[model samples]
Target: MKERFRLWSRAQDASPPRIAAAKAPRAAAISSASRRPALPRGVRIYAVGDIHGCVDALDALLIRIANDVKSSPIRNWRIVTLGDYLDRGPSSREVVERLIKLNELNCLIALKGNHDVWLDTFIANPETFREWEPWGASATLVSYGLDLVSLGAPDRCAALAAEFARVLPREHADFLRNLRNHYVCGDYLFVHAGLRPRVALRDQKEADLIGIRQDFLRHNGAFEKFVIHGHTPVEAPDVHKHRINIDTGAYATNRLTCLVLEGAARRFLFSDTPLPD
Candidate 1:
């Protein structure tokens, strides 16, 4: 498993595509009358983008964030990882292990992504691998010591999924299973994907929360709160008046983004050293 994980490490180092500058309107300084949401006084939130099995990037980003915290201390700090922690890259096992470790160290809020839901669905019915494989699930299986060709028969697929259940660590399984759909901190709403337009946060559908793309992505109206999400990969942290997307395609681009929020201030931190303005 270790050797197989190493083989794909180089793939994780490739630079991400440069997105045409984010088309969103430039955010201006917040004033007392500003409509934008704000975090609770004294609370600092670091919302990370979709990881997609890039353990190396994730580790680097975490260290960067820890260093940032050390430089400027805050009383309350939270780490919110928008999911897709599996698939696409190498070391899905390592990513989950690191997340488990992070949870022990900080106030961690892990949200479920569509890929994670697919994994749970596959665990319930291995036949879904037919659907999951093409969407990068094969990489996750490979990390767990399963070969794609080995699941040729439906029965074999089911058997392999059972074996996966037995082999996957209980801590990781629980971490995935117990992930939240969304978390509300002060005035910001953290979700794995964009929410359905006009739907109240509490009334949002599960599909929209973790899977909806275009409809949620294109909406320009205000949501119940400022929606901080991942799922739809943007070239950079696309900040708009209505939403903020920070996925940055970590698995393919090797740049994991983190959105930092304190009071009404917003900034970005990536896997690399240069911080966003």
Candidate 2:
């Protein structure tokens, strides 16, 4: 079945002609000979976008990635997940378990998303459940065999927190505690959300790294690195001179995207196969 899946490259003509014109000024303004963003020679990075607990999609995508590597081997490769591995889907528990195992293999670089951080906050202060509930917290709770109706009582914040902490596996807690805010590779910065304009990458705040939207999205200026991020859902992958957003709302749309960067080429692999609900 993995053999059937193929790497999908963005057609050169797929992008509107205006996009090049829009980006030309920024590239020229940055540097007269600014070359296309690229990774180190012979290195390949497969960065997966917001999982949102879609384990089936994650599993399928991993298989596709494995097949790609087997067919075309590279010496130095990395699989970086752009976070949101929990919430919004039916398999949050399974998702964490899979990620933990993958991390142990030393090939996975997991970045933290706002939802993943919220899970930690929710575990510590269940009062935050109110904030998370609207963003698919109940699905995660249910995945862990917790009854939302019982946990959702008006005054059960402490009780809910205690119950959650007790049920959460130790490795899972460790995984959440260890998630990185961002990762850099060659000329690309992989972050959960877009970066704040004009801020140095080293000084970016955690909150903005996993949550900020409009300010970063609206900024037309260039940054120190070409950013590849998730967090905001778009109908399709949004690629520009500055950043690439690969979050296609996997929890709802079932289209889990993985952006592939090898040298100067960019392509995509997707796990859009429907699974049983």
Candidate 3:
């Protein structure tokens, strides 16, 4: 199984097209075979990396997961999303709605990623809007639901901005306001980005969790229980000896990855599937 997984991951890394094809079939298979049993218990921590506005993908993944747990013999099911829940791709609005709904229904812990920090900054300081490229000012518009192009006149920018503010949903703002930075399961710490090897999980800054890539992944994580994260979409889930990365770059590509760690046996069940668009 290990060898087969390695081969699959490597084939995915072989090319961007290959990665998509690889992920799509693997996910499709899981959906077809997964039977709906009762929701499993016992702390099976299922983690997703970065979902950039892929609502359909997320929906499909969740349904399959539901089917999987129902068929399994367990007591509980828990999900940890590594952030990047908003921006890019399509359906940012729907994505937030679904996540909030998930939290309401089950045991879910959503962490903040760099994209989320950008979203926060966009909300707090709309002036910083011009800084980013295509995605710049996106969150501001999303929060307000006003088309920047439709502003039409320079004079309306401020008025449009205020209108946008008024239209903003209170709960939507509250959700972003309340998003947590990290999550821990058993011996492992799940972060959006990563932590400095020397720094304790509690000591890591908010910025560190949303951003920070290489210095963390490149280093021999050697942390306790392994740092499971999303943020940097890996070829597959980077199931190394120390860390696991399940972000399959859903926004850019069409694939979403999930890391399913069986609660009882402590074994890993990797399932990748398409977002139900």
Best by lDDT: 2
User: Can you give the TM-score per candidate against the true fold?
Assistant: 0.85, 0.85, 0.76
For lDDT, candidate 1 versus 3, the one ahead is 1
In model 3, where do residues sit more than 4 Å from their true spots? 1-20, 23-41, 136-144, 152-161, 264-277
- Residue 186 CA error for candidate 1 (Å)? 1.3
| Residues forming the 10-long window of minimal summed lDDT in candidate 2 | 16-25
Q: Answer with 1 or 2, whichever has the higher lDDT.
A: 2
Sequence-dependent TM-score of model 1: 0.85
Evaluate model 1: give its lDDT.
0.79
Residues 1-277 of candidate 3: C-alpha lDDT, one tens digit per residue: 1221231332233322222454432221111113321113466777776778776666656655665576574565677888888777666777777777667665678887776655445445555455542552454355347666676423344455465567767776677777888776665678888877787766778887778888888886366446778878765556555666778877666677777776323333333442233
> Residue 133's C-alpha lDDT in candidate 1?
76
Q: Rate the local accuracy (lDDT) of all candidates.
A: 0.79, 0.80, 0.62
For model 1, the superposed segments whose C-alpha errors exceed 4 Å read 1-33, 149-155, 274-277
Which has the greatest TM-score? 2
Residue-wise C-alpha lDDT for candidate 1, range 1-277, written one tens digit per residue: 1231233344334443342233332454342326668999999999999999887777667666766787788869889998899999887988888778667665688898998877678889888977887788778877877765765534477877887777788888888888888899998899998899987777888888999999988887777788899898877777777678898887777888899999988987877654333
**lDDT minimum window of 10 residues, candidate 1:** 1-10
Model 1 lDDT, residue 230, Cα: 89
For each of the candidates, give the backbone clash count. Answer: 1, 0, 15
Error of 1 at 21 (Å): 15
